[model samples]
Target chain A: MASNLRSPLARVRGLGSAKDGTGHWWAQRLTALALIPLTLWFVAGVLGHVGADYAEVRAWIGHPVTAGLFLLLIGATFYHAALGVQVVIEDYVHNEWAKLASLLTVKAALLILGLAAALAVLSILFD
Target chain B: MSAQDEAASDPKARRPLSPHLQVYRPQLTSALSIFHRITGIALAVGTLLLVWWLVAAAAGPEAYAAASGFIGSWLGLFLLLGWSAALFYHLANGIRHLVWDAGYGFELPTVYASGWAVVIVTGALTLLAWIVGLVAW
Candidate 1:
């Protein structure tokens, strides 16, 4: 069974499939599923703390359970966002070079932002 | 477009996409699908608000004040409302997609019903969230 049915011309030029099968699709769905509950929890938590003092909200996030959820939520949120925005870029940005540059910029920015947020959570938890 | 690829078929004027906008009529099904992506991307951008609030809180009381000040401002509240609406739309539509992946709801009536259901649920949840957030304190 020839799994790679791509034309030799296409193969020679090497502008074909992304080759990773359903990894992107699966990861997107998994992250979406994880977000279902995480997002609800977050919305409720934020609403609960509305109009509360800084110390009150800080203590809430500093709690072990809340911090743990924040970590998970941060990781999943950024990963999911990067993957998604990448798809949108690929879809509308027809120019090859521009698409590549945008995707790179977006992924890098999200990575940095995600890490910063995670670190903030950890700092809050341990401080 | 590569020379070889463009020669075979002009990428800009790509052919045989049967349901393209030129011939396709917009319907609930297509509109809902569009909103799914729209809301999804909006939420992706909206994550910035979350990150900023978290980092500011971790910084100190003064920083938290800055963050909360912005979030409490009219513009921030407006954006928050949009973000929450987008979140709910994406969440509800996402669940519909999950059910679709599970191999049901492909029937036309079912699909239309689910699409409407997603919209209704999004509206209800967003309203609930805003009331609970803005007034329940």
Candidate 2:
């Protein structure tokens, strides 16, 4: 029982503490901080564009500021989501092999989707 | 005792599992904490819809129309409503967490107050968004 106590540093790093203590925790919080403004802007923008046609939506995304903010939103969102789901998996998935596999799979999938989303935004902006 | 000593003395002794959920009475703090994680997962799954909408919009009018058509359906609207609720709840609760991280709001009264605030604020925000969405549409 005494041996089970994690150091403060380990707790700060969250589940996996591979040298850089608090890195994962800080990343999660920082991304969450970033998302606050980005998500609000996105929600408001989407609401503003409700029922809009293709051209209207396309033009919105094509605007330089909109495109830049959206790209930032995409990157931050997917990265934060991956970090979050990773912790959830680590907590509930008891089997070691299954846990590792799921973590890797989530990371890969989010990476691909993030890139795809960025590409979609870029194509719209450029087109 | 040291690991080796314990192992030698009680070879069959193994690590015990932590207490399970059923063992404890549910409380607001615990419930809200669990909900935060649940909504986090929900939002992750909901991201697919966002990605699809973006890709469809980028693809062409035809693709955009298809995506919009589906999203306009009853089931799609229902899911979006739920997703919006989850998003707002997660957002509100996340701010609460940030507040906690700042080393305030740890008092029991404050914790419960913030928990209820999160719930109420989320409901209000979701309703507002949906109303605005419908009006805009």
What RMSD, rounded to one decimal, does every model reach?
4.0, 4.2
| Runs with alpha carbons beyond 4 Å of true place in candidate 1 | A1-16, B1-18
Among the numbered candidates, top TM-score falls to 1
List, residue by residue over A43-123, the lDDT tens digit for candidate 2.
999999998888999999999999999999999999999999988997888678899999999999888888888999999
Give the backbone clash total of model 1: 0
Computed on C-alphas against the true complex, the DockQ of each candidate is: 0.70, 0.78
Predicted structure 2: lDDT: 0.91
Docking class of 1: medium
Off by over 4 Å in 2: A1-17, B1-19
- List TM-scores of chain B, every candidate: 0.88, 0.87
Q: Write the per-residue lDDT of candidate 1 for residues B8-43, one digit (tens) a residue.
A: 455666557656788899999999998888987888
Supply candidate 2's per-residue lDDT for B92.
100
Which clashing pairs does model 1 show?
none
Query: How does model 1 fare in lDDT?
Result: 0.89
